[model samples]
Target chain A: MIELVLSFLKLGAVSYGGGWTIVGLIRTEVLRQGWLDEGAFRDLVAIAQVTPGPVALNAATLVGHKVGGLAGSALATLSVVTVPILASLALGALISRLGPRGNRFREALRSGTFGLLAMTVWAFAPEAARDPFAAGLALGAFGLAAFTKANPVLLILGAGALKLLASFVLA
Target chain B: MQASKPPSPLRLFLFFARISAVTLGGGYVLVPVIARGLERKGWMEEKDFFSLFGAAQSLPGPIGLNAALFAGRALAGLPGLFASALGVLVPPFAAILLVSEAIGVVAAQKQARAFLDGAFAVVPGLVAALLWRMIRTRAWNPGRVVLALAAAAAMILAPGWAPAFFFAAAALGWFVETPGTKA
Candidate 1:
């Protein structure tokens, strides 16, 4: 439990850029610590995405729940947000002082965040490659989400429904 | 309907709670909804909210959550800050707990596994799309492109050591982008 909370705390501290950026970090940490199997973790990320919050925060809470139960969930949620709240409270005034360099700082952070996203995409590539139907859905999802304004929730549910239908047909 | 006075902490709590509960699609989608809602209530103008949101983006955590904290504090001080924090957090916590509990039951069913497998499959594609957008949006200099690719390669190689690589990228970007700042 303590280790679980500790990991979230550390991840929360470096979780600059946004939720997506920190997601890859969470994946690496959880996988490295042997907390969840790959398939389970992948499912968890899917759940986290469709849920109504930050993906990273949802992932943290769910991972905590799985790893340490209800008490773990509460503590992990608190732990993940602790640093950001503290930083927000403490450095609320610092951004203004950053001047033009602030843009540079943000751009710099972007360079790192891009890598984080790349790692995430890389890590999950195998899941997309698991089957032909899965690959098609993945490509379809990328096309719609990347090129159009289709809601991701719809995409997720649509894929699930299609897969379920296929399961029934194939069975 | 203009709010003549800043919202009380409890009011702020309810306000944020309501938004967090109904808003979906994570930070990018949530932030705009919040800004519009605040505007609609006359609690904060979109301009003021977005400027504060700009500050919020500079911090870590989800932009939606951070924006709430900043807006709450700006409107109603320390009490509002904590209240807003709770508001943003509590709904999702409840929602996820319910879903996880439900999932644990259905997970044993064959259909459920297939659906979940399909749902999970889109993740890589979704993330890849996100990366594509990031790549398109950035004002990428050649040097920055090289740096980002190098950093990506390193992080992919050593996922466990991602934090170090991230910091190294940030520091290098900071230094290399502006030679005039320190000198």
Candidate 2:
């Protein structure tokens, strides 16, 4: 239990990017520590996404529970999440002080963020764009969201139906 | 250093907790929510919101996680950090626990399965829509577009390359801009 909490604490403390980044952090930590094999870690990510709640939270809970039961879940979650919270706050405060200097450090951070964001999306694009019909649905959904303020959920349902129809027609 | 008094920690926590609890969509969506919330409270201004959005997205984790931590830390020091983090998390955590307990009731039924089939099917599109919004944001530029394309190509070509590619890109950006390198 102690180890589980400690692991999550470290994972949470350092895993700064987001849910996706947390996966990598967890992979490194867990695999290095022999906590879970790669296959199991992958399975955990899948299960975490489909199950509900925050993916990161779910990941932490599963890891903790597996190693230390309910108590482990609590500690793991706290460690993983709280660390980032403090870290973000600290970073934000630091950025505030730099205060509109247009310094290279700040500019670089901004540009890097844009690049990272774009790259992150780019990484997912192909698979996400794989189904032509799904792609159209995504565009239409984006349009609805951008223009009509339609509930995103509705567009999603519409897209799934489109996919189902495609399976029959295209197949 | 301009010494302005920081806001109360408890109030900041409550403010963020409300934001987290009410947010329907996940992390990215919280960007707008926090922006609006912070603006209304006078905790941060518009420029601050945009910069924070960029920094938060760039840094790596969930936007809400970063936002909560940033907002909390801004309002107070360590105590503010704890409050903000806890505030954003507790509501969602509690809600999930309740839902997860009830999730079993719907897990096996035919009707439930049918409902979930539809729900799961829509997920891919939902994911795409979310990605599109993030992609089309103002931060996007030609260099980013190329990086994105390459990243996508790499991910598709080798499904296992996500972490390496992402970190490598970040490292590239970091090192390329390192102060000494620029000079």
Candidate 3:
């Protein structure tokens, strides 16, 4: 149980992005740690998304169970979640006084945001490249978004549906 | 690192809780809201704000939670981290708890029925749009264009083939776009 929690803590401790990057990180850790194989890990990712809870929580629980059953699941979950929750509260307190106009702080925030954007690009790169359709769909979707002020949700649904239609119609 | 005198723990807690409850959408969506909230109050300069955001992206955990931690640590050091963490978590925890308790009661409701049906209907479209946006802003490789299409084919043809299709797409992007380098 302790090991399970600690491993999850390790994941939280080292990751560079949110749910997105965590996917890659989790893949590396789970495979390296011998917690699960590629097949099982893939399945878990799907289930994690479909499940109602947060993706991280589902992942932690699954990893924990593989490592040490119910107890492991509980520990991993707590460890993964604890640090960030605390940090956000402290931030809230800080912000109440600083305001956005503070120049230095604002610069830091902008740089940080830029860095995040870059990282997100890094994170999504691999997924975007492997499949031609996904690539085109994403590009078209992006073009639509960039060019028009359309609702994002509509774009996503349309892409999925359009692809399905294309597959059958073209086939 | 110099630790500032601890701020009131309660103040820290309430502040984050309010942010969490009011924030719609995900972490990215919360960025502008948080920035405005802090900027208006004068607690952090824009540079510091961006820096924290960058750091948050690089950190493990949810972006929202990461923001809380960065803000807390900036405000009051170690103790602040603790306060913010609890505050951010309380809302989701309370919400989940409430939903779990009421799950049985709402299991047969008409509103619930409509919500489930309506929400699912739009999910694929939303995914498509988000996937598009993600590609446009982040995955702008010509090679990625090819992979995404292939993956989509694999997914539709072989139901439940594997999410590896997606990750594989990402990994392939790094290779195809930049030879001998993995993203």
Candidate 4:
């Protein structure tokens, strides 16, 4: 239990850029620690996606549960959030103290985040590239999301439905 | 109709809980949803909300969780922070636990596999759209674009060096983008 808390605590602190990068970090840690195999990790990512809230939190909770049941889940969730809470408070203080000049720091972080997000796209590109149909579907989704105010949840569900329908027809 | 009276801790907690329960696609998506919710509730003004959001983004950890903490702290101090964080966390915590237990059964079917594969494939696009939105909101400058490209290249070429890359970018951004620096 202590180990679980400590591991996630470390991850929570360094898991910058959020989103997919955090997911990748969790995947690496879990695999390295022998807490979950690759298949289970994949399922966790999928589950994290369809469910609400931050994927990193969801993944941490699931991992905690897998490792140490209810207690583990509680601890892991707390561990993952502890640093973020403190960091936000600190950043808030810094912003108030520095005023407009602080804006540069935020901009820099945002720039770095853009890069990290691009890496996320790069990481996932191979999966889409494996199948031409999947690639086309992804491109279409990108266009819709970029141009329209469509709900992302619906877009994801719609893609799933299309895939199911296509598989049925083709098979 | 903005309420003159301050919101109770319970109200603050419930507000975030409701947001966390319904909003999807992760932290980035929550920005607008949260802004709208807070605006409608009159708990915060627009400028304050964005400032808080910017701080949340700049800080390490999950953006959604960080936002919740900031919102809670801003509203009711320490107790409010605990209340809001708990409220926002419980739903996802419960949902993930349930899903993790049931995933084995659900993932076994062929159709489920195909559906998940398809949904997963769209994630990159979703993220890309998010990046595009971020870029659009910012001033287009050579330095910013160059830094972003460098970080992305490092991330791809050497996955293990992500933390170092992010730190380097942050340092460079501080130096190059800071006030009084030559454009």
Q: Which candidate has the top score in TM-score?
A: 1
lDDT of 4: 0.77
Better of 1 and 4 by lDDT: 1
- The CAPRI category of model 2 is incorrect
Two-chain DockQ for each candidate model:
0.63, 0.21, 0.09, 0.58
TM-score of each candidate structure, all chains considered together: 0.93, 0.64, 0.51, 0.88
The TM-score-based order of candidates, best leading, equals: 1, 4, 2, 3
The list of candidate 3 runs beyond 4 A from truth reads A1-16, A20-79, A82-171, B1-9, B139-183
lDDT of 4 by residue, B63-146 (tens): 777777777888788888788888779889888878777777888999998887777778778778877777777786788889
Q: Quote the positional error of residue A84 for candidate 1 in Å.
A: 1.4
The lowest-lDDT stretch of 10 consecutive residues in candidate 4 chain B is B174-183
Worst 10 residues of 2 chain B by lDDT: B113-122
Query: How many steric overlaps does candidate 1 have?
Result: 0
User: Per-residue lDDT for B1-183 in model 1, tens only?
Assistant: 556678899988898888888776678778888899888878899999998888788787877789899999888899999999999999999998888787777777898888888887887888788889878877777778988998899989999888888889988888767743321
Q: Which stretches of candidate 2 lie over 4 Å from their true place?
A: A1-69, A96-171, B1-7, B39-54, B134-146, B157-161, B175-183
The alpha-carbon deviation from the true structure for residue A32 of candidate 1, after best TM-score superposition, in angstroms, is 1.6
lDDT of 4 by residue, A1-171 (tens): 888998888778766666555665566568778999866776676677789998788889989999998889989999988887777655656765655666676676666677677776776667665788888878888888888998888888888889889999999
- For model 2, residues B1-183, the per-residue Cα lDDT tens digits are 233456688887788778767664456556677788777777777677676565554343566777666656656777887787777777666655554445547545544433334333333344444445645553544654565566546644553444455545555545444343320
On lDDT, the leading prediction is 1
